[model samples]
Each structure stands twice: as C-alpha cells, then as structure tokens.
Target: MVNLWTSSEHALSYLAIADAIPHRTEGEGVLLNQVPKTVRRILDLGTGNGRLLSLLKIDRPQAECIGLDFSPTMLAAAQEQFMGDDSVHVQVHDLDQPLPDLGQFDAVVSSFAIHHLAHERKRSLYAEIFACLAPGGVFCNLEHVASPTERLHQQFREAMGIGDRPDDPSNKLLDVETQLQWLRAIGFEDVDCYWKWLELALLIGRKPTV
Candidate 1:
C-alpha cells in the first residue's frame, strides 16, 4: 500500500483542508487538557506543519519539543513554523519504522497521524512510545479511528464533506477499543479513549511510575 503522505501533492492537499475537518478543535482541546503544564519535554509524531506542537508550546512554553514527519513538504512547513523558536526541533522520520533515539519525553503527541500505518506497526509503535516515555509520562493521540460499521464510516466521511469519494488508501484505522487494549497491554496505565466525535477520537495513557 502506497503511503500518499510521502507525495508532496497528497500532503499539500490534506493540509489545505486540515483545519476544516469539523469538530477537530474540540478533540484538540481535550488532548491539550491531558498534557499537564509541568511537562519538561515532548515528542510529536507525524507532526504535520507542527500544528499540535505549536499549540502545546503555548500551554507549556518551557518544555522543549521535537516533531517528526516523513513528508518533505510537512517537514519543511514544520521547520519554517518553528524556525525562530529555540526550543523546537523538526526531523524527518517515517512512522512505519521504529522511532529514533530522540531521548525520553514527559509527553508524546500525534494528530491525525499513525492511522496510516499497518495495524501491527501501530501496535509496535505504541510499544516504542511506551519505551520512549519517562515514568508517569503521557501519550496523547488525536486520531482517525475505524467505525463500528460501514454505514457509520460512510456517515463520517459524509460529515467531513467527502461524500462518496474514494477513501484515502493511506488510512489503516484501528478501532478505538482495540487501540485502548493495546495501550493497556503495552503497560500504559489509565489508558482510555478520552474524547471522541464519530471517527475522530483521542487515545491517552500514562506510563506508570512504579
């Protein structure tokens, strides 16, 4: 399966409409609430244009942040957005592979990313994220998850104003329950779906201190 995100055209197309994804801000709001103001450092995966990272920085200005994206277009845009900020770093990384040694973080975040990975890769990434977190750290993923039925899936697409158009082949959405289970299995304490609006949901978990 081709990951459209690597193509500049595909990446640009999505960014053009990224903010208008309807009810997206609500999910982001919930994600922000979970990341405490005390975080010292954070990592963002597939951080398209560094949108989510920028928001987090506003709440925790002292926290150093790193953002990763495979798409050159996205990486460039993220770098440009954070160019003047001494605390932000943007790097090129393919989420399908293992995460690099960016050092442990008090928080790891992602927005509308990760669903593009194979289900197995998603699980492995979750394990890797757990490994990369400091004790009692947080992971917040505001993602596009699978619907319980084809009808509901179609409804969500329609709600997004993409009625009947072919679905993005890059998306490999997993169900919320399954993802929450994976988090718990990976030893993420207090794992749960913190917020949801149709297919868009926030999955959050904490690394246990003990």
Candidate 2:
C-alpha cells in the first residue's frame, strides 16, 4: 500500500493539527535534553517542516543540520522554514528505501515518523542509522509505537481523541522492546526507550566510540 504521507493533502492535514498533540512538547523537550550541545552535524530523517530540527538548533546553533523528507509538501514547508539559513540543509529522502549517501553525523533524529514502514524495514533502518553516525554519535527517535495489548492500544487511541475511528492503516507499529533489541543487535550501545507516554515513545541509542 502507498504511504499516505506522500499525498500533499494528507501531509498538509497533519501539519494543520500538529501542534495540538498532547504532551508532544514534553517529549520533544526530553529528546532535546539528551542530545549533547557539542554535536557538529545532525541528520533529521522524515523531517516534517523542520520542526524538531528547529528546536535542536536553539541549543546547537553552530551545528549544521540536514532535514530530509520525501513528501513535496513537507520538503517545501521545511525549505521555506529553513530558507536563507545555510546551517540547515533541506533535502529529499524516502524512508521506505535505503538511505542515500548523506555522510556521517554527530546525531540523527526522527519525530513521529518511521512507523509507516514494514516491520523488517524498521530494523534495517536502525542498522543504516547506526552506520551513518560517527563514533559516540546519538540516535534519537521520537516514535509512535505499538502498545502491549489491543485493549491498551484502543485506550491509547481514545486518549489521543481518536475514539471509535478507523485507525490509520499507514501505521505499522512495533513494540518498544523489539526495537530496542534491534538497536542492540545492530551494535549500538546504551539502547533504551528513554521516555514514553502510552503509544508515543522516544527510543535512543549511541554508537560506540571504540
């Protein structure tokens, strides 16, 4: 099935209500706190309008960041937001496919993206992300993950004001434990779910310096 994110309408619709997501800022804040200020180059995958990258820039202002997304609407928005700021590079990239040669980064991040891919691709992407990071580099993914049980999943949806509505078929949610295991298997150190609120979670891992 084609991902809805590729559609301009679908992309725009999400952006329209993006700010209303409850506790999102809190999670973003925790994610930011984990990233070191000394980072020089950062890579943001599936970057929607450069929102998270914009937050990261406040602390790591000297860091050159690449905000990548395949959707034209998202890319346009990100481009418009980061325009005239040479420190931030907005580029096109599809998460469903192998990442292009974008060079190594001191930190890599993604927010509310990646769940659209198949389960297997998710693990492979973690491996690819590990390869793209410099030694001691951090990978922080603020994600929409699967709940332990279907009942809990329903409860989470209700809490998010998604009561009784047909779920987004685009989401291929995976459990947090499995994703953390994948990170460890991929040779990342300090793999863990650093913060979580029901279905929303922040999974972080670091590339070993040695």
- Model 2 agreement with the true structure over 14-86: per-residue lDDT tens digits: 9988999888998999999999999999999999999999999998999999988999999999999988999
RMSD in Å for candidate 2, one decimal? 0.9
Model 1: residue 107 alpha-carbon error in angstroms: 0.2
| Model 2 per-residue lDDT at 47 | 97
Model 1 / residue 191 / CA error / Å = 0.8
Q: Which candidate is the best by lDDT?
A: 1
Error of 2 at 156 (Å): 1.2
lDDT of 1 by residue, 87-147 (tens): 9999889999899998999999999999999999999999999999999999999999999
Candidate 2, residue 92: the lDDT equals 85
List candidate 1 stretches off by more than 4 Å. none
Query: All models: lDDT?
Result: 0.94, 0.93
TM-score for all models, in order of appearance: 0.98, 0.98
lDDT of 1: 0.94
- Ten-residue segment with the worst summed lDDT in candidate 1? 1-10
Query: In order, how many clashes per candidate?
Result: 0, 0
